[model samples]
Target: MILDSSLNITLDNSNNAVFRILGEERFKITNAGPDIGGRLQFSNGRYIHASVQDDPDVDELRFKASGHLDEPLRIYGGSNYNKRVGIGRLSESPSRPNEDMSRFGLDLQDTGNGYLYGLRLTNDTTGTGGSNGACIYYENSNMYVRNFTGGPIKFKTKGAQAMVIASNGCIGIGGITNPMYTLQLGFVNSNSGGAQRHANWNYLNSSNNSFKQLNGNYGNISIFVGGHISINGVIVCVSDKRTKTNIYPMNPVKSLDNLRLLNPVHYYYKDFINNPSQLQAGFIAQETKHVLPTSLEMAGQSIPNILASASYYVDSFKNKIIQFSDFDTSKLELDNSGNFYPYLRVFDEENDIELPYWITISKILSSNSIQIETKEELPSRVFVYGQYVDNFHLLHYHRVFTTFVASMKEVDAELQKEKLKTLELQREMNELISLVQTIQK
Candidate 1:
């Protein structure tokens, strides 16, 4: 709202009212226009004007005509002019636009204080020639505006930079000043040397306040050291070594690369020429990357060399394990070597148990399709001797004696190797000691 001359204004039954002075209002709203129950009067030389807007139930501007209009009053916004001199309707206050984006509704201005408290100007048509076509300026200063019910301040940027509603002191919102905020979209903020939160993804051009959405290339919401921001959504946040932010862009892992790594070969039948120890049936190591047996030149073999013996291959183990349930009942295969292979799955479970033996498995075939299997106990539940993958029912038990014997064998092998090395070292030391003694004599 623009205030040029001095005037004594009295309004009745009005909603959001503001007293404009000089600088435009983009700070905040703390004014609800006088709730007049009688007629309104405007004194002094400056013309009495009002920009009345609002919904059907909301009285834009109303004045008791019976009251005397001893002064001239001009009503544009929701200003109630009973009978006054030089009474004229300047323009209607802008209102909430419809979905078609045809017209604009209201243009909020400062009422002396730095806030959008009351309606000062209204551009009805809101098209090319509407009064709301442009905007009012609100510099950063200590302006105070009050809201009756705290009607939300609105914004629409044709080519504006950023709309910063600022204030020196903490903003105050009366009941009416704060209206019903539904699933609508717009920018409402109060910049009191504090944070500036944009509504509907609004942004300001670093140069000026042309009030527009964040369209052109520029950074979005930012929080600084003295600044703290919080957003709740299906938000994607990222923090580098230094800065932390709620929004960033990352290239999603594409299936093209994963497809290249996937193999149609049976998961269990993977052949690893290198690290023959891990490839052995009972080998228990973690994280092995088996370059799924390709027809490529590797392990001293040409392209067509399917069998390369005496090759020192390195097969990195993986945490992947076979779950009996992963194999479709009809898909389970029994090879001619009397081995049944089931499909592997990606169930989350800790697998750290290791059995020393060859991890032998036994299956007993019953007459009525019942099957029981047993295995030498291993550290993890990776293989169920004879149980299906579901619910982890009972399989045959591991022989306690077999496990004990396996442990003993491992200990004996280590001891024998150490003993041989110790003997050889002792012999060498004795020879050195004899030579030292002869030299001394």
Candidate 2:
């Protein structure tokens, strides 16, 4: 039956109604009307457009299906137009949706100018619209995981937060949520619960809080929480024969002569100046550089202008002192005056030797001319060496030890020569005694 010129309906042998458009089969309704279960099938290249009337109660265009809808309803397009499916707004362009609506979902844009050929998970449905949300997108051969809000991106495992990348670009591993540095590793508890476990690169044991490196053949380098460090194997420097050019044996005698110029001294650091019990034995880099220049390196340092003065004075306690008038008292630690203690050296004319004294800031007599006290009486002319200063001469102790070994070897050789001379003298004395006894016979 042809009700309209464009629509044609025909009844099959099974009494099913088949509808066609322009004489072609487009829709088939099986099992007829009044049946509880019926099937509506559409042909290829056919579209079913649905829309709800402007009723307050009806808000959706829903498709009711009796069985499971296993495949998705796909929209096919020709070469004339781009295919796009939007939930919030009907987008004219394939790249983004209409700017008026807040669309949030996945968008596979296929445009030339904006977001080219990739998948984007965006909140605003545009290329650059989200401000308070995060997006994981791929654009122009690059993939980006960006967070516009001031929050962290966390990665978890087994329902526990394992790692976090903070908004400030700090990465924290092993359940570290708030990292203060560029890369921080958190401490994790081991199964034994005896020590805290770190990442797989290193293991930190509980005893002395020793941290040891992993995956080394010779054994690990262990560094304790305190100042102690231990190496399991011999430490070898890069002294390969192929890397060297002009190498020669060092002169042991010359090294001994140079070593004699270095004066080893027992002194306390400025922090321990008041106690005096925590004394350290070392050579002043400035003095040692003249003897073994290779063992010293010059580095830039800053010092307080008050301690840089060359003036000296004797206090009433027979101690040598230097007073500074113009200085920031706030910068100078008044409670811990020993930290600013200056090392003073005086030449004793009677003993014909140089004596060292530690000078401490005893009194803060106003901003002008603060008084200082020394541990011993200083001579009229004294040389002051201030540790708190700019441009320090730092000593490389490994090279210093090498030079000391050369010097000691030369001393041992000289002792061997003296013993040979003593033996020769004793042989001559024995011969002389034997000849005198022959003359007496």
TM-score of 1: 0.16
- Local lDDT at 53 for model 2: 36
Residue range 167-281, candidate 2, lDDT tens digits: 9998998777798767877553543232244433446677877866553333323221212246676765556698779888778998898888879999965423223447679
Backbone clashes for every candidate come to 73, 3
Error of 1 at 250 (Å): 40
TM-score of each: 0.16, 0.35
- Range of the 10 consecutive residues with the lowest summed lDDT in candidate 1: 300-309
Angstrom error at residue 153, model 2: 4.8
Q: How many backbone clashes can be found in candidate 2?
A: 3
Query: Which candidate leads in lDDT?
Result: 2
Can you write out model 1's per-residue Cα lDDT over 82-170, one digit (the tens) per residue? 22122211123222222223222332334455544222434346434122332333346434332222332433356442222222222
Candidate 2 positional error at 120, Å: 14
Misplaced by over 4 Å in model 1 are: 1-90, 93-104, 108-110, 118-441
